[model samples]
Target: MGFKLESREASMNGVALIDDEGRWTLLHTTGERPQASPQIVASNSPSRDGAFVPEVRQPLGAVDMVLRFHVSARGGAASDDPRYVRDVNLAELTRVMRLGRISTMGLVIGGVPCVQRCVVSTSSSGEELSENIVPAAFLVKLLDGFWSAPLGEDRVAGFLRAAEGGSGPVSPVWRIEGPCQGFRAVTVDGVVCEWAGRVDVGQAAIVSGWQSWTVPASLDEWWVHPSAVSTVNVSDSSPVLPDFSGSYAVDVFVDGVKQTLATTKVSAYCGQTFI
Candidate 1:
């Protein structure tokens, strides 16, 4: 059978249950008609906050999710205390077929978990400003079947070797920060940076699978390809090399960004003296 996933909003204040195959069964507690407790709560598309409520898709057995709610302490009470407490015992409930395996589950407010019954005591008697102190909800997410690959020691050595002896205008700069995983490409300005093979291709996979990236050094005038090597004109009037007394300079590009490395000019000097 195909994997099933679904999410249902807890109605009023009740527990929403789901099975391994992703089916909904709501347990409602009527105020007066407790004997006629319905096995399946009425399906109503309640709007949550500003979003329409719908069944959420989830991976089975994942623990990255939780149930959510909105709740707070009611005002005008002698003490800061919640209007009512919603009881939930998942570990026990699941053992008794009351709850299903899901990634995460929690009652949360303002992105934080709301535990047990939110209570307002004498310590917060005059602090509340609202009549209805409904606390925010808990959300549950399941986390299972997640997989990741690890990097190898050889991969590090391979990358280091490549950086130490790479040929090009760009040099391998010692890593200062990172080359995170899932990064498919990198650009300096608008130009894509090409990977120079110093490390074995196997090592490259290690970096990719492990989420590490390499740092590169700047390159000066150097041979790129037979048709595209950078060059400097020594006899040109504009003096390519500014600062000191260097005669000529070559421009370099890394990942399409211009490099600041300087290259010495190779030109013949000529001057005529008058007697």
Candidate 2:
């Protein structure tokens, strides 16, 4: 009846399938399996010595999932015809697989409920006459690799507030929920950085979702230090300061509406030893 999968804590789980029109179907499944296959891209060039070495160009690719289920054929004694039950259930599955262009899939992995958008890549059904049941399988793919946080509306709002406060001493670290394009972090002093990293929530749904971003913590070599304090002394006497920290702002657009979080006071501290 609800919109999530039911499972025992710390054990393998099953998935609940929902159609585009919000219709739900709980599969009578024996096992649920999800696999991740990443594509490897490589290139090779001849060296001066004429030996060719392969160079990896692209490493990651889309993930594909295969779901298996066991269909039951049981009814009241009067209408308990095994073949009839199998036909009806098979037809129902066919309708779900065809009409549901984009659907919501729910499953639990390591006691965490994962929900995401998915489309059926392939599916098949076969009749097991001896067992008087039907066996069904589906291959689905995720559009992204992030999982939606299982937080309520109130909790989500609170999380956004804390993330805007930032994480590290120099720059603020922000935990962002996705189903959006991208995000930007800026400080009161005009320090800005664009986030472009991925977080692996899990493989239950196999799609991408929201991500967390920290300013100086995740800067690495990709980010260029702001011009204002690019030449500050950061030796033992003083540590290199993060360009953006307290009183910062995070901007993101969700469902065509721009959402912004502004924090009041953020502080940075330096550890020192007086000999």
Candidate 3:
């Protein structure tokens, strides 16, 4: 069969999943779920003040896609094929499918534009015509779970939830230049997180990933998630979706911290992994 669709699109390594070439047509895509579980158990030492439910963050497991397309043998696209040139296009699709994650894979999805790093796990294709066309599909594991907008700082709404999470702003991925005693970041969505560690001029601090953060050139240079000290939970009252961005400038208060978005996108999509 054929899919009559528009307004939604996806790509891998810059190849459009849906295009006018008639080589491939995206039918349906599922598995954009961000599997974020909290770190409460990671450091679950409730000192009474720690009694709050820790933010649960996990990772998006995998995504499965269904597609249909047509091809011709003499078109120089693929091997000999009939049924209105179905297998020919299937062969053309093999290149995109074979593109492994290691070779700088680029995944951009969403109606508004979100990017992620992903690798195909498994896929299948053939000339089993469902209606004068080939039916096929693939499964991929998004390495970073949540998708971050590729460029443009002002569009990220601080968190990456799902494709239908509405039109949010770009992720405020940033870095803090030193000379500032303490740094505090409040996302466009207002999920606040802070760090008491001081940064000397020349050193910079940032939330590297969902795992741990660092302050380069600092003596202790020791690391912490910071969300552990004072942070928000999976179901923090202020928001609906989980803040997998872990862009931790949380709902906690630390005296004398700099609140700035100048460094945003400075680190280029630092720790904006969202749910």
After best superposition, candidate 1 residue 107: deviation in angstroms? 17
Number of residue pairs clashing in candidate 3, backbone atoms closer than 3 angstroms, sequence gap of 3 or more or interchain:
26
Q: In order, what lDDT does every prediction score?
A: 0.22, 0.36, 0.43
lDDT winner among the candidates?
Answer: 3
Rank list by TM-score: 3, 2, 1
**Which digits, one per residue and each the tens of the lDDT, describe model 3 over residues 32-125?**
4445333343334555543445453233344433333333223433444355465656666766756455322333443345566667666776
Please give, for residues 215-275, the per-residue lDDT of candidate 1 as tens digits.
2222221112122211221111111111122111233222234333132111111111000
Candidate 3 stretches with Cα past 4 Å from truth are 1-7, 28-85, 99-110, 130-132, 151-173, 185-275
Please state the error at residue 232 of candidate 1 in Å: 31
TM-score of 3: 0.53
lDDT of 3: 0.43
lDDT of 2 at 19: 24
Comparing candidate 1 with candidate 2, which one achieves the higher lDDT? 2
Clashes of each: 65, 11, 26
lDDT of 3 at 216: 57
